[model samples]
Every structure is written in C-alpha cells, then in structure tokens.
Target: MTHKIAILGASGYTGAELVRLIATHPEMEIVALAAERKAGMEMRDVFPHLRHLDLPTLVKIGEIDFSTVDLCFCALPHKTSQEVISALPADLKIVDLSADFRLRDPEAYETWYGNPHSAIEMQKEAVYGLTEFYRDQIKNARLVAGTGCNAATGQFALRPLIEADVIDLDEIIMDLKCGVSGAGRALKENLLHAELAEGYHAYAVGGTHRHLGEFDQEFSAIAGREVKIQFTPHLLPTNRGILATCYVKGDAQVIHKAFENAYADEPFIELLPLGQAPSTKHIRGSNFCHIGVVADRIEGRTIVVAALDNLTKGSSGQALQNANLMLGVEETTGLMLAPLFP
Candidate 1:
C-alpha cells in the first residue's frame, strides 16, 4: 500500500531531506509540497540538489487537500506548526518536526518557547516521536512530536542507563557538539560561512537551552523523580552530525552491558565495543546512531559518546520511521540506507 504523503515547509533542510528519503521509500509517495514563501515554485528551484526527481510544485498549506494525504510531515517553524497543524484535517495523521508539541504541559511549553501553546487540545494528544522508546504509541498515534536533535542524541546515551539504575542521576552531564544544520536552514549572521568556519563555540550555556525541557520531562518520567542533567551544546563548523559526550558515575562495563541489552534488538542503534567511541563522520547523512562507552581513570566514572546526522536520525529519518509504523508498514522500510562515509 503506497501511503500518500505531503510535506509542509518543503523549502527547509528537513523538508528537502524528507523528499530525498521518501523518494526512495517503497511504501510512501510524496503527493504534495507546501511552502508559504516558496509557493508556486518547484522544489528543485528551491533546492537544486533535488532537481533530479519530479515532485509537485510547492503550494500554500491552505491550498492542499489534506483529505487526500495519508500522512503529513510538518517541518514548519515552531509557532507556525501549531497553527497550521491545528487547522489540518482532524483525522489526518501527522509527524511534526517542530518543537510545538514535544512538551506535554502547555505551561512548560510556554516557559520554554516563550509563547503559550496555541493548540492545547492537539498538544495533549500528540505522542512523543522517539521511535525506539515509544514504538507502540507511535504506531497508534494520530499525531507524533519529533524530539529536538540534541535532546534525541542525549537521551540515546543516557535513557538506558537511567532505566537500569546503573548511573548516578545527579552527576550526569552531557556536552554535545552539533553541526549548523540543526539550527535549520534559516539565515543567521552567525551561520554565515565566513563567521562559522575555522571555529566552534558553545551556546545555551547554564541550562538555558530549550531542549532542556524535553530532557527534564523525559528523564524525570523515566526515573520516577526530577532528573536534571548539566547539558551544554556547542555549534560545530560542519553541516551535519551531532557528537554527544556524556559523563556519568557508574561502572563502565555495567553501563556498556546495559546499552547492549537495551538496543540488542533495535535496528538503527549501534552499541560499540567497550572502551571504544563513535564519531560523527561514521554516521553522517544516515539514519543510524552510534553509541560507545569507555571507563574513566577514576573508579565508578564512565563516559558515553553518541553520534548521528542531526538532520537524519535526529529529524526527518525519525519522522519517516514513525510514519512507517503509523501506516502499518515495516518500521525500517525506507530507513535502511547505510551511513555515508568519506
């Protein structure tokens, strides 16, 4: 069964990525493309890299007939996503890539996003789209909220340890480095080639980054208590990938065993051998996440490293994975491509 799909915000990086991946998907077909600003233009005109394929010309969100779309991937900006998704057909399944529906509490959403959620009722029903942890829920969900790239990477490193009680909760600290693509395709003075190249710097220091809300909500729920970890993210000069180095107090071997056990049956997650580490280069442009663990010289302290393309496993690839489940197709159908290596 070919599931008809529409991609809103078709001009953005994630939108183009969805097009690229779905173009090869066996059970999914892109039927419509929407971009408010790029309306009436072909997707290839906006992203020449996609010029090879034939796709519907971009249109305004309101112009598309959602009744015909089996599922929609909303890659729009946060506030915009809520308004657009709220107005979408009630029965239409959705996978939202924005931060709009990620936090369950409206107040928490306001506190982090600085705006009260405009679609509270819809937010309540949106399943968190962390596919590995919420597979069953995603399969049945009418709406799924994709996690922040950084949040997803961090959780992959720590969630298993937290669930197994193998790590010290209070001492957990994650220092992550992300490529500029995670910031989105929007233009920023800081993201310019001259300004960002040949350098790397940290932002959202001192627990100020918005993704902390997701980390707080998810980790707290898992541990059955308030779990706050020191999280600081750095902006790298590259165009893809995320490398998260996590520090936890635990036995290295035990933590390694815990991850191996948790992800043993999972397809996209790769747990490396003990004392080894993964690099962003290995998983670039792929829907795979590589995790590795190493013991610190100090007893009872361990280090965990995780890597993936911020735009793939971190966003579009994840959306497609969930869409597969929702459509009753194999979860790994379109996501089996190998990581691009140099």
Candidate 2:
C-alpha cells in the first residue's frame, strides 16, 4: 500500500519537510529526491537533521522516472515550476508547492508573476489546494496547486465570514506576520541573521503582495462579485509559522458562531473561545490551524486571529494532505502528527 513519491527541489525547506513527513508515513515512501543544483549529493548531507532517514541521492528533475512515481511534489521556484511541470508526464499526479498554478487565469498569472504562464492548459486543470474547503475537488484532481502560506492563513480566518455574509466584505483588512522561512531557503540580504534578528518590517505594502491574486479569486468567487481585501504582510525574525489578524465589520458573536458552524467537523481547524487568540508556537511543525475571535470596543467590529506553521500547514503539509486524498487514502492519514510545543 505504500505510494511511491518523488520530491522535486528536495534541497529547499518545503521539500525537506516533505521528506520528514513521508519518512514516517505508513502509506507513502520517498523513492526519488530531485534538486537541480544539489544533484549528485546525498539528501542527508543537504539537510543534516534528516540524516537518520535513508533516502535517495538528490537528482535533477530530468533524471526522475515519472512513470514509477505515484505522485510528485514540486517545490521549485515560480517560473521554473511551470516549465518543469509542463515537461513532466502529463498524466502524472502532481501536488505543486509553488505559485505557478495557483492563479487560474494566464493573464492574472503574468500580472502577478511578471511572466507569461508556460502551462496554461495544466493551470486550467489544477485545483486549489486548501484541504478543508476543497476536499472534493482535490480527491479527483490529477494536479493540485498549494496556496500561499499567508493566503491560507488569512482565508482560514475570513472565508466562513464571507460565505455566510456575517462580515462586511468591503471593509475586510488582514494584517499578517510571517516567519522568515516562508521566504524560502534562498540567500537574501534581508534574510541574513544579522539583518533579520531584530528586524520586523512590512513588505509588499498597498496590495502589491502576489497572494492578493488568490484572495481576490477565492473571495470574489464565493461572494459572486468583485471582493478586494486590504492585505499587508510583515516579516518576523523567527523561522516558522504565520499569524494573520483580520479586522472586519461584523457582529462578534455571530462571526464566532460562523466559525463554529464551518469548522465544527474539520479535523485540523481549531476554534478558541471568545476573547482568546492563538500563537504560532502552538501549531508549529504541524498541519493544524488555530483560530480565535475577539470583539472590539466598537459595537460592530471583530478581530479574528489565526496561527499555523508556515512550513507545515501553509505549504508542504498541505501538499501531502492533497496527495493523500488523490491516492484514495483517508484525508487525515499520515498527517496526524502533533504540534511541536516549546
């Protein structure tokens, strides 16, 4: 019953996370690990913490035998993901952890990513990979596109509100803070230990963050009209998790009730009591999302906060969740790992 899996871009943080999660999975096994630049190297040498697990040496994407891979997790960077995925076996099951296929419209993809999408046909067929809401779609999908960690965090806070019309959609504002690991393992001047240790600054201000494409697509589709949210993201000094605080015009108690009704049966979504909020530490290294609601002094204002590990629930864990569904396994199988508490 073991599903043979291949991980492209295995040297990256998300890719390594896939390896860590699969190492213990009863129904899935890592058969090939691909890293373009790190090809010909041992996976354990690329990620020391994973030295205990015996894994295949890193190879280039071109070197993987897709016919033997039950599913492939693409953790490559943006433009590269589309080019590589387009060249992959068209019938291969793929769970993409990149931004390439998340946006449906080729024009929208180019607008946000600054390049024309090279795989529009596949983009049209890829299902959005928010496991809680897209369960049915993912179970039948050959390709699933993982959402932005920030986008996933914010949506977990607000989607129910919008669906039930409990909040004023036009006044929605999401102020999110993300761990440095969400930036990926790429070398950057701002990500240097010296530069990031005490630094907390907002980037992609004024709706420039590409995840807006997701927020707009999902929210608008649900509301049956154009819905735009004010979203601003900040960089945290830490290495994991995302905290998204949403400010909205709504009846506080009713919105809390909405979350209760929406996630009452969802395995990974946790609803905290009124006046409480979640911390990123509580959900780190796990596929759980904790949401809390607080009422503002103003009669019609409510603040909803959500927390999850950027590397787990936000990306790689999400990919694995979709893969399980695609493989006809239980939705929560191989993903019941407890959150790492400090």
Candidate 3:
C-alpha cells in the first residue's frame, strides 16, 4: 500500500521540507523530484544537507511520467504552479502549495494575483486544504489547495471564534509577523542578511496583503456574510515561523473555551491555557500550531495569538497532511516529528 510521491519545484525551502518529511514516511516514497531551473543536478547538489540520502535526480516537470506517481506536491511559485498543474493528469491527486487554486472565484484570483486563473475547471474542483476544518472534503478531493502561511496562522486563532459567533465580527483585526523564509528562497535585495537583520518593519499594511483574500473568503463563508478584517503583516529577520496576534471584541474566557473545544480532537493544534501566550520560537520547525488567548486590558476585548513554522506546518507539512487524506493513509504519518526546541 505504499504511495509513490513526486515533488515538483523540489529546490525551494518548502520543497526541501517535503523531501525531509517524506524521507521518513513509512507509506510514502519519493519517486520523482522536479526542479526546472535545477534540472540534471542532484538534490544533494542544491542542498548539501540532504547529501546523505539516495534521492531521485532533479528533472523538469515535463520530463517526469505522471502515470507512475500516485500523488504530486506542487511547490512552485504562484502563477507558475497553475500552469504546471494544469498540464498534469486530471486523475492524479495533487496538493498545491502555491496561491494558484486557493481562491475559488476566478475574478478574486485575478483581482488579487493580477491574472486570470488558467485552470478554472480544476480550480472549481480543488478543495481548500485546511486539514482540521475540511478533512472529509480533502479526503475525497482530486486537488487540494494549501493555504497561505499567514492566512493559516490567522485562521487558527480566529476560525473558532467566528464559527461560534463569540466575537464582534466588525472589530476583528490581525497583526502578524513572519520570518523571511516565508517570502520564499528566491534572492531579493531586501532579504540580504545585512538589510533584514537588526530591524523589523511592517509591509502590506491597510489590507494590502494578498492573504487577506483568504481571511475574507473563509470568514465571510463561516459567518454567512461579508467579513473583512484589518490585516497587517510584518517581515521579521528570522528564518522561520509566523506569529499572528488577533484582536477581537469579545469575552476572553469564552474565546478561550471556543478554541479549546474546537481543537480538542485536532492532533497538530494546541490550545494553550487561559492568559498564556504563544511564541514563534516554541513551535519552530514543527508541524504544530500553538494558540493562546487572554483578556485585553480594555473591557469587552480579547487577544488571540497563534504560532507555527511557515515552511513546515504552514506549507509543505500541510500539503503532506492533505495528501495523506487523499491517499487514504494515516493523517499523522511522517508528520509527528517533534518541534525543534532550543
């Protein structure tokens, strides 16, 4: 019952993470590794840390025989993934880690990503890959769209509140800080060590971030109305993790109870005790999300904070979780590795 897996765009951080996790999976085997830019090179050549394992040589996506791959993890860039995935066999189960099939509406996709979705039919069929909330859907889906790291962090803190109607919807605000690796492995002048270290600043202020689309869509769907929150994300100097502090007008105890009750059966979500707060360092390099809730100093207000590794639980790990459901394998397989702690 072993499932053959293929990882497209295997040279990036998230792709490498998939390799690291899949290497230990008992029921899954990596049969194809595709990295168009790094084609003909061994994965060990691109990532020396992986030099010890015998891995498939990196090839272009078009060169792989999809019929032999039971499932594929698409970790390519935003628009690039849609084009590559569209060409993949329709029967192949896929877990896409890019922004391609996340937004269901093609207009919303075009509005936020600035282009029409190339795979409209496939987009319509793809299920949202929020494991805890969409388990059944993911299990039967031909394609699952992995959420944005920032979006997933925010939702982990707020989804329960929205579903329970325990918060004032109009007053919801999320302030998030993310490590630089969430921006991707691509070289950017701003991401240089000298420029990013020692200073942290906010970008995508005033609802300008693309992940806001997910917050709006999911929140609105849950509440059965238009739900828009003020979302601001900051780029921190570190290499991993995302911390989202969500502000809401509600009872702190009630919010805590809601999260605790909602995540009681979830394996990867840990709801901290009341008045405690989560830190990014605690869940670094793990497929775990820690959430904490506290009463704000102001009356009728509460703060919910969530922490998770952007590359692991936030992306590739999530892709693997969804793929497990699709393939009828144990959801926690290969994902139970403990968080890296100092």
Best candidate (score: lDDT): 1
Candidate 1's TM-score: 0.99
User: CA lDDT of each candidate?
Assistant: 0.95, 0.94, 0.94
TM-score of each: 0.99, 0.99, 0.99
Q: Which stretches in model 1 have alpha-carbon errors above 4 Å?
A: none
- lDDT-better candidate, 1 vs 2: 1
What lDDT tens digits, residue by residue, belong to model 1 across residues 220-290?
Answer: 99999999999999999999999999999999999999998899999999999998999999998899999
Off by over 4 Å in 2: none
What is the alpha-carbon lDDT of model 2 when measured against the actual structure?
Answer: 0.94
Per-model tally of clashing residue pairs? 0, 0, 0
Q: What's the C-alpha lDDT at position 5 in model 2? A: 96
lDDT: worst 10-residue window of model 2: 327-336
Alpha-carbon RMSD to native, per candidate: 0.6, 0.7, 0.7
lDDT of 2 at 275: 87
Q: Compared to the true structure, candidate 2 yields what TM-score?
A: 0.99
